[model samples]
Target: MLITEKKHGIRFAQRMSDLGTETAFVVLAKARQLESQGRTIVHLEIGEPDFETPAHIVDEAVRALKAGATHYGPSPGLPEARQAIARYVSETRRVPVDFERVVITPGAKPIMFYTILALVDEGDEVIYPNPGFPIYESVIRFVGGRPVPIQLHEENDFRLDVGELLDLVTDRTKLIIINSPQNPTGSILTAEDLEAVGRLALDRDIYILADEIYSRIIYEGDFTSILHVVPEAMDQVILLDGMSKTFAMTGWRLGWGVMQPTLAAAVAKLQTNSNSCTATFSQMVIPPALFGPQGPVEAMRAEFQRRRDAIVAGLNRIDRITCRKPAGAFYVFPNTSRLGVDSQTLADRMLQEAGVAALSGTAFGRFGEGYLRFSYANSIENIKLGLERVEAFVAKL
Candidate 1:
């Protein structure tokens, strides 16, 4: 019966067996492994910005290091960083933020983990968007919460359907997750949608977690945060945002969650007990990144929009590929079922044979079965080359 028959074995917690993962990382690892063997992989799989963190933000971190700011810091982050974040959030989201309620983490991940662990108890229903971030479902299941998915679709322009979403909400739902400029599909939830969700959350006494990490990356119209519409959402209304997407600082591992005082305290305590705190030098860069000159941010956004246009147009030009121009974020989800291969097989064939890396729609959820998420977070040159390879690959199929 193998090694386990000996009973000298070690085993993981039952919950460990139930956990899911972000397939992006798995694809990234495969891409890296292929690259190590001298393969020229055109990466369109990962969501990280190809841009560097602004020099100003980098300078601040250097300054902090030179100033001997390295040490264990406050669990809720430095006062200065929190205050700067407060101003930044208040200005961008059009909502007043309490600095005391902000908890900075090593990355945006722990904020999700802590919030889910703190709020979701066994068997409670949690509503998250299908064809959305994999982590939301993973966290819910890890906590033993019943994950209820709201199916997103291309016909509705991938807009969050309030009626469809609320229909899934029962008295048992403890949390509802909303992500705009969303991952994989890059679909957005409108202000009206947010307002409806806010009303439902308030009426049902459900907590809301809005992941607005890509708020600054909008291509069309104005960007709306949950703050702009969900102020009255009953559950402390945790808002997660950070430097990773907006500032192209994913490697920095800096992000935060804004919440009400009570919940913030629990998160801070979680930070103290578990994470302790984020890096001091990283925390020190917030003011510069937030209150600095707006030129770099604007320039990067315009470039991303240009790339978005190129990729969407290019993908649509490929026979049997249908892509909707996303309103925000740096991804375009294309329906590839017309090619007569499942998304996972298509992704693998493209990566291994064509040297183009992308994520399968099934990586997100069952609703994403016929799609593939192509990230435009690369240069126009690379994006075009990758699509050319994809086009050639599809032609063969």
Candidate 2:
């Protein structure tokens, strides 16, 4: 009321306009709105795992809380948590990782945000996979960096071409981001693909941010990490991973980054300025989640594989819509271009008419046009029901 009483308006920073958002949350709100009006929505719009967090993780959090783990921890993270993550990554990737290089955060997005802030100068170019995570471009632009997109073509099975990526690099290139098993398209980068990018980073002295959050959810073959593929480039690589995807602990808001110690120090300083530290009790669960029995993780992965098969088959059976079986992650990027409208319109229609909530491909990037992303993180019954509704909607078209 005080501000409204004045004739002048408050001004937001110009950078606010440059920041984009994850469209899944927007669709989620609309889906919830429709549900309030008595419609049943089969939600595949959001990427969160539908399963509960395994009990052991929750038990650790409760135990820690009871033991007075609620106080503020170090800005970088609790030392024990970082050490645990280091050991876990070392054993899995087969590349020795120093605990000193790991920095924990409230969630993985903070790592992404802090990284761009730490490395990118104004007007510097950052190459990232288009139709990848929207936050990658959003943070880059927010920090006044030029976003150079390396398109991931569906024909190439949505994998980034190393030659194409290198073509986009210039004197201004400072950072390159690669996500795999990637978001939206759900494509895993091959060992050969990882090696090519790693070698390029080594030669050009560019930093690579490898988003390996879904590394534990692969359907075929052992998951390959960039650190394993090119151990020499370890100093130049920043790994973004967390318990969110693997442990179904998205709401726990716990994640960490592994990078060169110097950069980790800088990112840790940024963490100090921003979130202070991830919640103490949340950080307490990291050790057990990483070292405990991995059965729950494997169970979820197996279930996701089953759901992936069901959704891909059901989507392909629909007239004019074809979906690729994703090698990892819980999403399926289905081509809906054969229909008359663009991605957003189809997505809107799917929600309004069919009560099936999903995201437009363009939500990820412009290259995402003519496609739509659906997270198969829902149940088989919901996936089947959503597919049926979408089939009916398409038939009416």
Candidate 3:
């Protein structure tokens, strides 16, 4: 009787039982803890830009707050903000979008989730890229949809094979996800690939979600959006873009989704029920950010290009590592298999032994086993130091 005990806590939803997670933040937290203990940790694990938000953007937010823009606005977003987004998309991406089709959310992630929720049903097939953003797969599973992987090979510069992708689509497929200037690998989809997939989407009447968050961070050839190839896809295509990457406004939580009117309404309903709306003051910054002078953005892009060149050159000098100069985005996904260790093991050893923190390829997907993603969004000095530490660690091994 004395040993008898009460029952433990009740079970949570079974859908959440096998949910996956993004590992970038976990590695970031561990790096911070190590730094707190007096360790000099060179962080290459996170995807955030190292620069501050532009002064004009910040000032706009402050002005909005002071001008009494604190009240709850529409759940979809402020009309002015939506109009600015629409205009920006039309001018930049060449996609003629009506302002009524735009829905501003807290960040790009919400748009992904909302789009997935609207299209995916139980057991419905959804195609997404492996070695891509982890959240795409996670959210697909969260909504009881079957996630089909479109394998991206390192030999192909991590770009998707459109023929192979189309071969995997079935009659039950409801949605397909694509990311350009992709995360982790930083591969940009080719115009040919985009055209093939765009035609497929049009023929199959399937919904397409294009994650173009890093559209402005390219280092080489012109950056292209799928919207450019399929201008008529304004209704079926949902384009996700934001100030987070382009303007370094991650903390501001400003992002907008461009979709057809009906889909936009659905997403707005979701917002109304969940987040209510994005922060009022943040919405006020969209106009200035969209139409302001392009000086800061160009400066940041030039700096990122320099850092990319430095990291790629340094990694190429290491005998045991192979990396390509990423076409866009602020990451270098190098194949670490020549080091005689798996990515996760190498990442763990590097963090604890070399005082250099980075993300394992396994954190992205199973296809990412032999690679590790190093974000070059830090200072050039830090990038050089991190590579040196990594080289030393490989030598000792």
In terms of TM-score, the best-performing candidate is 2
Question: Candidate 1: where is the Cα deviation over 4 Å?
Answer: 1-9
Predicted candidate 3 versus true structure: per-residue lDDT over 250-299, tens digit per residue:
88898989998998999999999999999999999999998998899989
lDDT string, candidate 2, 1-397, tens digits: 7856998776899999999999999999999999999999999999999999999999999999999998999999999999999998899878888899999998898989999999999999999999999999999999999999999999999999988987998989999999999999999999899999999999999999999999999998989989889999999999999999999999999998999999999999998898889999999999989999899999999999999999999999999999999999999999999998999999999999999999999999999999999999999999999999999999999
What are the Cα lDDT values of the candidates? 0.89, 0.94, 0.91
Q: Go through the candidates in order and give the clash count of each.
A: 0, 0, 0
Superposed Cα deviation of residue 145, candidate 2 (Å)? 0.4
How far is 28's C-alpha from truth in model 1 (Å)? 1.3
TM-scores of the models, in the given order?
0.96, 0.99, 0.97
Clashing pairs in 3: none
Better of 1 and 3 by lDDT: 3
Clashing pairs in 1: none
Q: Give the TM-score of candidate 1.
A: 0.96
- Candidate with the greatest lDDT versus the true structure: 2
Pairwise lDDT winner, candidates 2 and 3: 2
Q: Which ten residues in a row have the lowest lDDT in candidate 2?
A: 1-10
